[model samples]
Target: MTNIAELRKQINYHLYRYYALDDPIISDAEFDQLMQTLRDLEAQNPELITPDSPTQRVGAEPLESFDKVTHVVAMTSLANAFNDEDMRNWLGRIERRLPTWYPRDAVEFVVEPKIDGLAVAIVYEQGLLKQGATRGNGLVGENITANVRTIKSVPLRIPATPDGPPPPTRIEIRGEVYMPIKEFNRYNQQQLDLGERVFANPRNAAAGSLRQLDSRETASRPLAMFGYGVGYIEGAELQTHWDALEYLKAVGFPVNPDIIRTKNFDEVLEFIRQWMDKRDELGYDADGAVIKINDLTLQKYLGLVGNAPRWAIAYKFPAREATTKLLEIRCNVGRTGQVTPYAVLEAVNIGGVTVRQATLHNFEDLAKKDIRPGDTVLLKRAGDVIPQVVKPILEARAADSMPYQPPTHCPDCHEALSHFGEEVALFCINAACPAQLVRQLEYFVSRPALNIEGFGVKISEQVAQAGLIHDVADIYTLTKTQLLSLEGFAEKKADKILAMIDESKHQPFDRVLTGLGIRYVGSVVAAFIAHAFADIQALQQATQPELEQINGIGPRIAESIVDWFSRPANRTLVQKLRQAGVTLSSSKVEPTAPQTLANLTFVITGTLPTWGREEAAAFIQDHGGKVTGTVSKKTDYLVAGEAAGSKLEKAQTLNIPIIDEAGLKKLATE
Candidate 1:
């Protein structure tokens, strides 16, 4: 192979490992270095860069509108099974249609998650991605090739694993493109902070992200694909559904890892039952589990019942909804000072949980829904999200009830509220708003923030309401006797809380910044700002341009930081925190540790004997070494302990040195 071709192959292999398989044998820096080299090589020899090159996934020119795609094989739907009986009925139908030669007991089934996402069909020609489209009308769909190309999980070239299955001449794969629930939440909050309208759920977020006209916009979203089945193929024949999924996985597609192939019907139901209860644990949202006849030939024989396939069925989870009376409309002032509306509902059971309240989302959504007190509202509890008011039963509204109004003032402080530019959320701009401060206090002690152990939310609210603490900074100045005077505080509990508060004062500046509850400044973003600015004084003095220049510090975060520091009351609070002996700079003012492992890079995996992963990473950084997520040839050492899985194996493969916790400490102190 030519040098350029081999280089591109190597890059594609690493990309497959990193994106498709979620395992990497290279550090991010090494991967970046490889990409940079390829970019330079392509610049030197422009014609060498093909459309399937790793460098060519993004930067497609924007189209006025998406083109249409007519499917060679229709993207058919599946009938749904709400319970075991429904699933049994489907199996019975399949049994009745089965040829006499094919025994019913010999039938095998493949059960996979029915991802609550956008259904898409992607085509491949000569192992390279040809085109991708949304499942528009079964036989026809919108061409979203440009947008799909940007999804890293959707491989540009097939057979991601070396020496895997050879490419088919042409193949059509069907999959669901989805956003992880956690990523969706974070992305939605970021959008809201940037004054953009946010998606109500992960499924909507994935769909909206995948359908963006600009490919770069799609690239920026965290979209992933899981191949479920095949629509059409030439030069390849698959006999079983399980084999098809396996073939898809071998050829660079990420299939659902939880797919189970079983001959027993009871096993299928058991898998579905387990998944229903554990739905929240799946990183991505799934509305149901799909059961398919494993034999492909049998599927073809027992096919086409209306728009749905007769051989497959979706076992949908019970819907989480209940009709509850809207007792009242309430407003809550959040830490960022956004006053959001919520519903005070009469106690109703939704999905086994007695939900007393539901999120109205924001004032704009409330106005759009026209939900009023005394109306019966349909509540939906989706996984871990706060139960939401889907819609009100307009016919069930009381004659005396009037349309609910969004709060005109801050609910707690009665301060005048205002809209932020074109944003829908109303903000209480009062710096000393008591309700906002209580939320700030609650957040300041959260596990991801300062981590004031034993300092619970109820106590934070109690102290704030009792006039013991005015702001988060005042937490450091709280007296033991004052805490003991509270409802739940005993002498022992009060002392422990005081000690935790003192310990929190020693928390790094990033944690302190996170605890401050600045708008758009999440813990991860706060860390970037803290590292870039070094000290509270430097951060306070940083202009919008200076803050925005830092990596990952966006305009919204920069503006929020600048606006936060501009307030005199906030400045005074910072001074109070500093006076209370909080470490405000990047690190404590002290002598530096020995730079023993200055030039070294390390990878940590599994449970360490004497140190946790974070602790070991901190120790390495204390002596000036870098720690990365993956093992690579460039990695100086692998700090490993019991059950160090793939990273250990990769390190061994590359002949990289391995060290235990003791050896790691020894090297750090050398």
Candidate 2:
């Protein structure tokens, strides 16, 4: 019998890591695989099924730091719909079980973003919060009252706003405690700066923060709530799930604004399809969306299938994380001659793409992860961002596999590789390295650089491999005859390339500086250097101390700038660009708006009406204000917008002045 007990034990152990510890060793897909195996076994051998089997529970047992409370209404899980066919099957099952008299129009469904977070049930006595607990094993849960009180969005009292109606005598509100994506990244960076261990994801951060032994520690973490549905209600009569959600929000729970309610099942599928592509924009990580029967009566009648509600199903998005065997490791040199490690995997599919290669980040990250060939590795792939090897599955490593030894020489040019002071990446530094030139040429003509159109990495590679261009400056020196000699270069294409290369000379000095492929001198930092130095000669002559005086230019960046200018070859390239008539100097432009925000600090969050987050931040900086990531007492104003999440709450709690996009414009122009 394949020892079904061992499978159960393994599932239970992983459940504890996922729920109680908030530090899962295996990926979610791996956990699901184990669970599915156990489920299949139990289905085949019904006599071997036990009540304590992981398949029979809602969640793991809560940590011992808090007291346990049993739920009146069990906090059950939902069956998952992974695809359109799976969802249709679920709908068919539900329709078959429902009363024949009920029309399709009468059945409405509510879809809520399934926040990747910790599920907790908050109990209220009259209008005040009485107790809060985790969804521990569905029936019993931990008493996390203190930590629950720390989350600003939880509403310590019902009807959190003044004009709302009186609350239910007793209500058990259920919501996911989550850290927003932006907040989680900022928090991780802050923790890293303080030499603390960073979390693997936002869900872990939220769960770990909530389970913190100290409530004060929990308070410092940027956490928020998104109420999905009520578990148990005493004094209210909610006929539908949509009405319940409305009542929960009306009585002051924070519900996600992007939820949809529809009578058509096609619309439900369409909603999930649309959200699958846009879940990143939600600010919080939502692995899927929860689809529930709107009618409370239908839910009650069709409830309970193992541990999940038959009336509800989770429309899971495509898996972004997967476990795959790492076959080999390769190195690629970037535009600045920085060599980085990447994994050549045994081809795993993540987010609907077959990822044969994944990033190892740098040699330092590769070393820290202890990744070796012939080991099973955890891989993560977000949209457009290249797939990355998160870590190696140490237990699955081959006994004879050795530690990865970085190459002593550049793979492309076969030249000795070296690293600069305090830098992680090994550098090629050979100006004529074929791979290095291709990347440099590509970056030189990018939108943030010289803004050259009709020139991309492919074209850069074609020109480089054909020996038509040696450096970025050589692009400006190329004639239509040389361009048309390359493959895929028609007369029109060749003319466009020549025209764009000529047009690139008109780009501001900052763009020219950025296009130089200098380490740490991105478009923004290049702008500061250009405005301060006015010309390439002045910048090259400037001292390290002078570069450091610029607001955004730090010691590391200054050192890189000084070192780049010190190189003889780099100076030669600068002269070549100057001879090509590329602008190497420009007069600074005056800001259209006055420095009304002088001496003030601002922090912008979420989606604004007229501007993106970075655009808003730049606007503030242009008007003489400092922009920071976190909300603190030092913040003069918080430029908040829709879906602002925890930062907005933190600013409000700190009594920092809050302003909208319009208000920010007013402040800048005042």
Instruction: Give the Cα-based TM-score of candidate 1 against the true structure.
Output: 0.78
* Best candidate according to lDDT: 1
Q: What TM-score, over all chains together, does every model reach?
A: 0.78, 0.54
Question: Tens-digit lDDT track for model 2 on 58-106?
Answer: 2233345788889988988888889999999999998888887677668
- Displacement of residue 271 (Cα, Å) in model 2 is 6.9
| lDDT, model 1 | 0.84
| lDDT by residue for model 1 (1-670), tens | 1398888889989988887788999999999888876775675467777988989876488889989999899888888899999999998898889999899889999999888999999999998899999999888999999999988888888876787799999999999999988888878666654445667778878989888888888887888889998888899999889888989988878888899999999999999999999887898887899999999899889978998999899999988889989999999777778877788999999867899988887778888889988899999877666688999998888889788888788899999999988877888989889888887888889888899988777987898999988878888878988988889788999888899999988889899898887777878888776655546886797778666656578787789889889888899999999999987876722237787877687877766777866578767766766565656676899998875666778999999999999999888787
For residue 41, give model 1's deviation from the true position in Å: 9.6
For model 1, give the RMSD to the true fold.
10.2
